[model samples]
Structures are given as structure tokens and as C-alpha cells.
Target chain A: MILNGVEIRDSFAEAFPMVGTRLIITADTAKWAMIAAKTVTGFATSVIGCGCEGGVEREIPESETPDGRPGVSVLFFTMDLKGLQTVVPNRIGQCVLTSPTSACYAGMEGGAKVSIGKALRYFGDGWQIAKNVDGRRIWRVPVMEGEFVCDHDTGSVSGVGGGNILILGASRAETLAAAEVAVEAMQKVEGCILPFPGGIVRSGSKVGSRYKGMFASSNNAYCPTLRAQTETKLTPEVASVQEIVIDGVSFEAVSACTRAGIEALVALGRDKGVVAIDAGNYGGNLGPFHFKLREIMA
Target chain B: MSGFVLTPRRAFETRVDLAGVLPGVDLSGLTVGYGDRGVALAELFEIGGSVGDRLTLKSGSALLDRVGAGLSSGELVVEGDVGDHLGQSAAGGSITVSGSAGAYAAAELSGGRIEIAGDVGERLGAARDGSRRGMSGGVVVVGGSAGPRAAERLRGGVIVVKGDAAEGAATDLIAGTLAVGGALKGKAGRGMKRGTLLLRSADGLAPGFGDALEHDLVMLRVLARRSPDLAAFLGGAFKVRRFAGDLNAGGKGEALVVPAA
Candidate 1:
């Protein structure tokens, strides 16, 4: 589909099933809340190496939070519920609990739960107090800085990961600028997150590798440096490619984010050094969820 | 919430115990006590109204005790004053009193919610005579002052008194939170083992309680958010003076008294 002078490739982005959960990390101020959000979401770009993928979904107002403090809502995704149960408590204990004047709560109310405060309450060393608020149980651990209050557990939801769209252009700078704006637009969709740094990934990977130990390697077909030697998916005019990977609590959320990102990049058109839009897939064999670029934009 | 309506036929000649009479069940076949004799409920008041999820006492009386005792489900609404042991051992459902309630309002309460619009008599949410656990699960909100030994032997749950509390408030609190809005008189939290007492004014506390430094406890904010009934006591940032004790029992319990506005 060609519109606004940009080509929308017919290819689809493949996504795998995952277990996700949302958490509200609140602090004394908005800055600290954002800091806590950033800390827990760091080093979490892909589940391949980091064991999870996470990003800040949005900033929550004081009136909406459990403790009436400024908060940042974050979405974390792991390959399975067991992995999510293990990784969530560790991240919350090491990041949110250590932050100054910070408290954590469950952002979503549905589905099964994983222990957050229930896992870290022992840090109080017999000083911890548990209170049931409304219907959910919460723990108050007396810390040096007053106390660290957190929900007993957070709900775990079914999610989709590795939903991506690749933006190819003539130059690295324009492609990057387009990718940046696309990320900014896609993040506006709730229940989803762009797990990569700045919501943009330059090294999009394909399954399998030449090295026996490595599970994944770079997408050589989309690489400009190897275009002459490898079977290229790009034309001669295509120079740089940047990918936006989305992880969301559902298929509809990932599709909405994909549509939003493509619309932002398409708004710039080819005159803005944009060449085309494409996606990565493994012949529809690896993951169950599929988002066709043209069908989504259509 | 339209359910059975029970109105008094005449002034009670003697005290009446109307416990465990909830709207969720068949009231026509039920029997209750009048003075020293057992009588059918229909003889005391007209049992007229649809059987649903609400039980409304058209007018509560001072002689009517245990109005909603052991209510397991449904809503019980009282339009006037009630006698002692108001919601004893209520495991579920909600009881709302539009007028004052007598002593032992919520003794041995394990679950559910109780909201009183006026004053409550002594030993509110306290342990029963033979039991050590008081108000183990659930919430009791009193819009007016409480009598002596309020929240005594509280093991869990929450109790918020919006008005002044007489002597010995939270006297033997074991756990949970109790926020008293007005002045607290005499030996509060004296034998507390683990619990939080948010009081506005506290004087003549026992020597077992030691004054701890002031702190902006997160529990205050948590209670403020979860229980809106305590908004009058916590409308702004609540920087409180912490008194840790009763050391004779265990030093874990804390009484956070907010400096008077």
C-alpha cells in the first residue's frame, strides 16, 4: 500500500506469547517517580538476554494512585508466568524498594498475582506490618526513610512480545528522526510499551546464528553494509533501518501501537528521506500473533 | 437494597436481643427473645417488606441489643439508637446505624463493615469476655465519640472514630489501625503489642510509652486514601509525633498523634 509517498510493505511482524504485569511505582515527587520507573525498566530491552522487557507506560496523577502520590505506571513482560513471578519481585525489591520515599502498587486488578511486597516484607526484620486496604492486602515496611508501603502482590496478565515495525530510509539521521517520532506516538497507547532504548532498535535480529552458541544474530537482509554480499530485502536507495518493538498485555494493544507508529512515520512521507515500512517474521512458524503492515495501516 | 422492615409495636417492657436476624434469610419463621421469655419476631414488630438483601429497622431502641450480631451477609440499616453488642462476631455484610449505639458495639467482629452516625458506648470493637481477639477482620467507623476501652484487644482490621474518645482508647491493641479524630483521654495504647493508633490529642499517657521522634508515616497516607471516613483527621500532610510502647507489652506498637491544627 502506497500512501503519502511512503511504501507500506505487505510483510507482517511476528509476536510470541508472554506473561505481563503492570505496576505503579510512586515517589514523593514526579521526578522521583520517573526515576524509579526508569531504574526498574533499565537493562530490560529484550527477554533474550535481560530475562524480561519493560517500559514506563505513563505517568499517573496523584488523585489516581493508591497513596495519593505521583506515580509512573510500568509494564513488564516475561516469556512465561513462572519467569514473571521470579523477575517481578527481584526488580521491585532492588529498584522500587530502594528508591527514596517510594511505594509500589498493583496497577491492574484482574488475573492471577505474583508476590511483590509479600516477597520483600522480610527486609523490615520483624518490623513489617500488613494491612488489608479495600480488598487487597498491602505491607508497610518501616525503612530509614519513614516506610516503604507496597501491595502484597500484583496481577499477572497474558501478553504479546516481539511485535515490531521496521522503518527504512535513505540516510541514518532521517531514519532515526522518523523512528523517534514513531516511538513517541506509539507510547501513547496504553497497556503496551516499546522495550528498546528510546523505543527504537537499530540492530533488529533474526532467529538462529552462524555461531553455535548464539541463538539470534543481526538481520543481515535489512543491513545496508551487507546489501552487496547478502540477499537484501532493501533497494539501493535504502541506507538505514530502525525497528520499533512493542510488548503489550494483549494482541489488540500491540496492533494499536503498531498502527500508531506506522501512521506517524507515514505522516513524514518519502520527501522526509523515508523510503518504506517493513516488518520481521519467521515464515509464520515461531509466534502466534501476526501484524501485517499494510493491513494494519489499511 | 429493599428488604424486610421491622417497626416496634410497643415500647419494650424489657431488654431485647435481636441478633443474627439478617435480611438474607427467611424472617417469618424466626424466633427472638423479649425480656426473659422467647417470642416470635412477628409479635415484637410487623415483618413487612420484600425479602432481598437489606434489613431496615424502622426505628432502633435503647433496649434493643445485639441488633446485627453475627450478621453473615446482606445489609442491616438502623434508623435510631441501639443497645449493647451491636455487631458481635459479624463475619460479613454491612451494618449502618443512623443513631448512637450502646457498649460493646462490635465485640469479636471478624469481618464486614459497621458505620455508626452517632456516639458509641464503651469497649467498641473490643474482645469478647472469653476471647482475646477483637475485631479481627473488618472495619468499624464511628462518626461520634467512643466510650472507654475503645478498640481494646484489637487483633486486626480498622476502626475510625471521628470524635473524642474517652479514657483507655486502644488500651490493649494487638494489631490493625484505629484513628480517633478528637481528643484522646488517658492511657491510650497502654498495653499495645502491635498496632497503629492515629490520635489527635493524647494526654496523661502511661510511663510505659516512650516518646519517639516525629515522622511522616506512610501509614497515615495509606489510611487516608483507603478509608475516606478519616479525611477529617487527615486532610493534609500528617506529620505526627510517634510514641512507641506500651513497652511492658511489646515496643512494636506505635501511637501516632497528629499535632492539633
Candidate 2:
């Protein structure tokens, strides 16, 4: 299927089931909230190396937050439930609690409930006071700037990760620009995230590895230098490839984001050497819902 | 009986547990469903009340725990006395008791108003067991004296006791206001962080509180006008002796002792 002269790859984007949590981190201002959120979501591009994948979901106004502060909602995902429990509190305590004038709250209401504040209350050193308002428990810890209120527990649920599309461009600059636009467009869609560094990944990986110690290795199929040596599928004009990975709360959310990112990239076509939009799939055997690039674009 | 009236059919001496009776149970149309000795609400109180403007529970000594727990809207009036927790977490409504009430009346109340014409037992407006915060919002007015530990660890809300308050009143209050018309001999405003506690008595002040300043705060007028029973203590205007601390407790709360000049 050709969408706006860009060839839609017939392959589907493979994904895996993972447990996820949404957190609302608030600060005195929107800028600080973004800083905390970005820090918490940093190094969390994939469960392969970082053990979690997280991204800024949205920005919330002060009136919308529980503590009346400007906040940002972030989605964090892990390969399993136990992995989620390990990654969430560590990141929140290190990134959010250490931030100035910041408070953390649970975005998900009732799911696989785990207590973050109940565990982190030890940081207050006998000064943390628990407040239960309207049945929701919040812990107020004495901080240098008066108090910091955080929800006792947050909810976690199963989500999908590794829903991705690759932009193959003739030059590195063209590939980076198209990837940036795709990231911006995908970020606007709710419940989905581009978890890579600056929402673009140049070193996309495959399922298996050549070394005995490694479980997975890089995707050599899209490597520009190996185009002539290997069973290359890239066209003659394609020189560089940039990948965008998405983690979403559901299959529909990921599909919607994929469609949006592809549409945005296609709109800014081939000025520098943009050739086609292709997807990475594990032979349609990994995930439950197979999102074919051609079918999704059509 | 303009509104709903709940009248017990027969007098009950033994405690008839009513903990889960009024949970999401509407009291629009007032009437007794069923009643007997040592029986629960299902056996005694008939469910016939329609959603209305007000609900009146005709007085008796039979009711036990949780009479009106989690009531969201409308009005509830007890013609006589009530059991414990008369209006626990009542979101939006007014509950008036003509006689005394048992322990934990209006515990953890969020919004609305509760007025008891008679005395109240211990732990009125205190937090439930194992819960941290207590009575985040609402206004509670007690006409007679109140028992010990009244408004303990209250986060936010207003509580006014017209008669003398028992020991440990307004202990560990985080926010909101508490006004007592009669004398308070016990440790008042102990470990308060940020709140206003007004004592309209000549019995002097608690040792835990230190004198802050002497001024006539006009906010008392606004608070008094909200409840007529509380308004009587203002008496047009009076000198408010302000005291700060529970210095023992970070020295944040202000205790105003109103002296008659």
C-alpha cells in the first residue's frame, strides 16, 4: 500500500506484554515538572538494557493536580510485574523525590496496587504524616519548603511495548529530521510513547545475538553499510535508517500512534533522501495483535 | 414531618447494631420499617424513605454504631440522642441531634454540617482506627459540653463546642478552626501545626500555648454567623487573646482566648 507515494511495508510491528504504571509528578512550575519527568524517564528506552520503558504522557495544569501544582503524567513499563515493582520506586525516589519542590502521585486508580509512599515514608525519618482524604491515602513528608505530599500507592496494568516503524533516508541528516517530526507527532497522541532517546533510535536491535553472552543483537538488515553484503531489502537510494519505538496502554493506542507518526513523516517526504516507511516484525508470531504497516496506513 | 421521619416502633435497651443500615440507604421518606429487641436494622427499620429535602430520625436509646455513615446529600435530624459516628464522612448535608451523642460523632466528615444540641462522648470528630487523616472538611457544632480528645488530628474543617470542652481538645490539629465557649481545663491545642483555636472563657490558657498577640479578629464574626449557637459567644465583639504554639510542636498554631471585658 502506497500512502502519499511512501511505500507501506507489509510487515507488522512486533510487541510484547508488559506491566505499566502512570505517575503524576508535580513541581512548583511546569518547567520543573518536565525536568523531573524527563529525568525519571531517562535511560528507560527499552527493557533490553534499561529494564523499563518510560516517557512523558502529558502535561497537566495546577488545578488538575491533587496538590494544586503543575505536573506531568509519565508512563513506565517493564517486562513483568516483578520487574515493574523494582524499576518504579527506584526511579521515583532517585529522580522525583530528589527534585526541588516536587511531589509524586499515582495516575492509575485501581489495578495491580503497590504502595510507593508507604515504602518511601522511611525517608522522612519519623516525620512523615499520613493523610487520608476522601478515602485516598496521601503521605505528607516535611521538606525544606514546608511539605511534600505523595500518594501511598499507584496502580499497574499490562501494556504493549516495542511497536515501532523505521524511516530509511539517503543521508543521516534527512533521517534525523524525519525522525524528529515523527516523534513530535507521536508524542501528541495520548496513551502512547516514543521511548527512545529524543524519541529516535538509530541502533535498532533484533531478537537473537551472535555472541554467547548476549541474548539479542543489532538489526543488521537495515544497516546501510551491509546493504550489499547481506540479504538487503533497502532500496539503492536508502543510506541511513532511524527507528521509532512506541509503548502504549493498549493495542489500539499503539496503532493510532503508529499511524500518526507515519503520516507526519510521509508529509515531510524525500527532500533529503527519504525513501520509505517500514516496520520491524518477528514474523507475526510475537504479539497478539499484528499491526501491518500497509493495513494501518490504508 | 415535612421531610422524611424515621421513628422506631418499640423502645430498645440493648445495643441494636446499625453499622451498615444507612450506607447508601436513602432517608427521603421517614418511617420505621421494622423494630424489635436486640435486632439489627433489617429486622427493625423498614426501607420506605424516598429521596427528599430532609430526613428526621425520631429519638430513641436503641441505636448503636454508624447511624448515618457516608451520607452524601440532604438533611438528617435526630429528634433525640444518637449512637456513635452520627455523620461519618457526610459529603453534603446537615445532621442535627436534639440530645446527646455517643463517641466518634461525625468522624472523618468531609463536607456539610452537624449540630448536636446535647453533649458528645469521647473522640468526637477524630480519625477512624488505622486511618491517618481525620475530618478533612465540614463544620460541626455541639451545643453542650464535649468529651475528651475532641477534634484530634483534624486536617481541615471547623468544630465549635458551645459548652465546656473536655481534656485534650484540638490535639494535633493540622488546619481548620475550633471554638469553645465554656472553660477548657485540659491540655488544649496540644501539638497544633496550623489552625485557629478560640476559647471563650475566663479559665485562662493551657501551659503548652504561648501568648502571641492581643487583637480582635473579624474572621470570628464570619465563622459565628455560620452557626447561631456559635454566634452567641462573639457578643457583638470581644478582645481575642492570641497564643501561639504548641511551641512543643513547631510553634505554628494560634489559640485565641476570648476574655469578657
Reference contact recovery of candidate 2:
0.00
lDDT of 2 by residue, A1-298 (tens): 6655667777788888878889989887899999999999999988878999999999998767765568899999998888888888888888988887788888997678766787777888876756443345666666665556678889987789889999988788888998899999999888887888888889987888888878678788888899777877688888889999999998889999999999997888666456789988888877776778878887
Give the per-residue Cα lDDT of candidate 2 at B192: 80
Residue-level lDDT tens digits of model 2 in B222-254:
345344544666665545876877888876677
DockQ for all candidate structures vs. native: 0.60, 0.10
Model 1 docking tier (incorrect/acceptable/medium/high): medium
Tens-place lDDT digits, model 1, residues B86-157: 999998899999999999999989889999999999999999888887888888999999999999999888
Second chain TM-score, each model: 0.95, 0.84
Quote the RMSD, in angstroms, for model 1. Answer: 1.9
- The residue pairs in collision within model 1 are none
For model 1 the local lDDT of residue A141 reads: 91
Evaluated against the true structure, the overall lDDT of model 2 is 0.77
